[model samples]
Target: MVANDYQYILENMQKELETQAEKVGELTKERDNAGKKIGALEAQLSETKVVLDELELIGDDATIYKLLGPVLVKQERELALATIKNRKSHMETELKRCSQTVNDVSKKIAKEQDNLRDLHMKSQHVKQALMGAPQQ
Candidate 1:
């Protein structure tokens, strides 16, 4: 009866270990995706800054063409600069949020990893005990 009880407990622990491992895998993927998003946002922000700088250097009277779905629509120089500035500002905000998400997810991943390791150790001990038990 003790052996049977140990067997049941070991089975439950195995299930829990599997569940924790799956969670860790999901969290790892989430962290990787957030990292990729941060990279993309940084590149976009850099491009926007370059465009804004170029616009600032040009004369106010100069004609600017805004690309709208492959069509170059005439736009006021000031308006174009303002639009680009807004885009840059928005990108900056998005980057900040994404960076924060990465940090938070990283911490969660670390915690989950530690939990998985501890569960694995406990499961190993249980397996050893189960194996050493006398068979019915």
Candidate 2:
């Protein structure tokens, strides 16, 4: 009877050991899953920081949007378009003023040309009259 009791105790201890080992294995798997979740979150955070840094750079310099903003970002596009429109409007006004100035100068030039023509005709007539009257 004593030998049988010893054998039963050893078998029960073996089953308990097996159960404990399975529990440890499950805990290890859960730890690895948690670690993976943390790693993914960290990577996403790094990407977000990079994007924010680029945005800060853009906001800092007014000149940056004209050169680098079109392909990379979309926030400052409306402001850039407004600036371009304002420049175009100014150029149109300047062109109109230049056109008016040119027109005025052309009219003045035409007036001068007409005056020269009249003077030339009068000079020719005076010379003809002088030559025909006192040929003796």
Candidate 3:
């Protein structure tokens, strides 16, 4: 009887550990994606800033034959900033989700450890019972 119970507990613990590992793996992938997205957004913003700087350097537009597209240029900068903000928001949400998943994984690992402890205790109890049995 004790052997069967021990086997059952071991099987359950193995399953729980596998599940926790898979969750951690998924969280890692999601975090990597978020980081990549943030990097792309930052690069776009930097490029837009460079364009704006060039526009500023053309301070005396009247001296130039062609007009300076200040309005359209500012709009481009504004849109770039907005895009950066949106990407940052998305990254923040992804980070939060990853944090939650990590916490859940920790809890699950703890629970599995507790289950192992229970199985050990039950095995000991079963051994004691078998030993206490009288001869027929």
Best by TM-score: 1
Give the lDDT of residue 24 in candidate 1: 93
Candidate 1 vs candidate 3, lDDT winner: 1
| Residue 109 accuracy (lDDT) in model 2 | 49
Q: Which 10-residue window in model 2 sums to the lowest lDDT? A: 59-68
Q: Please, what is the TM-score per model?
A: 0.92, 0.43, 0.46
Reference-based lDDT, each prediction:
0.92, 0.53, 0.56
lDDT for each residue of candidate 2 in 6-48, tens digit (9 for 90 to 100): 4574566555555655554554455455455546545554554
Clashes of 3: 0
Which residue pairs clash in candidate 3? none
The sequence of per-residue lDDT tens digits that candidate 1 reaches over residues 1-136 is 4777887998899899999999999998998998999999999999999999999999988989989998999999988988999999999999999899989998998999999999999999878877887777
Rank by TM-score (best first): 1, 3, 2
Among residues 3 or more apart in sequence or in different chains, the pairs in candidate 1 whose N, CA or C atoms overlap within 3 Å are none
**Clash list (residue pairs), candidate 2:** none
Over 4 Å off in model 3, which ranges? Answer: 60-136
Error at 65, model 2, angstroms:
4.3
Best by lDDT: 1
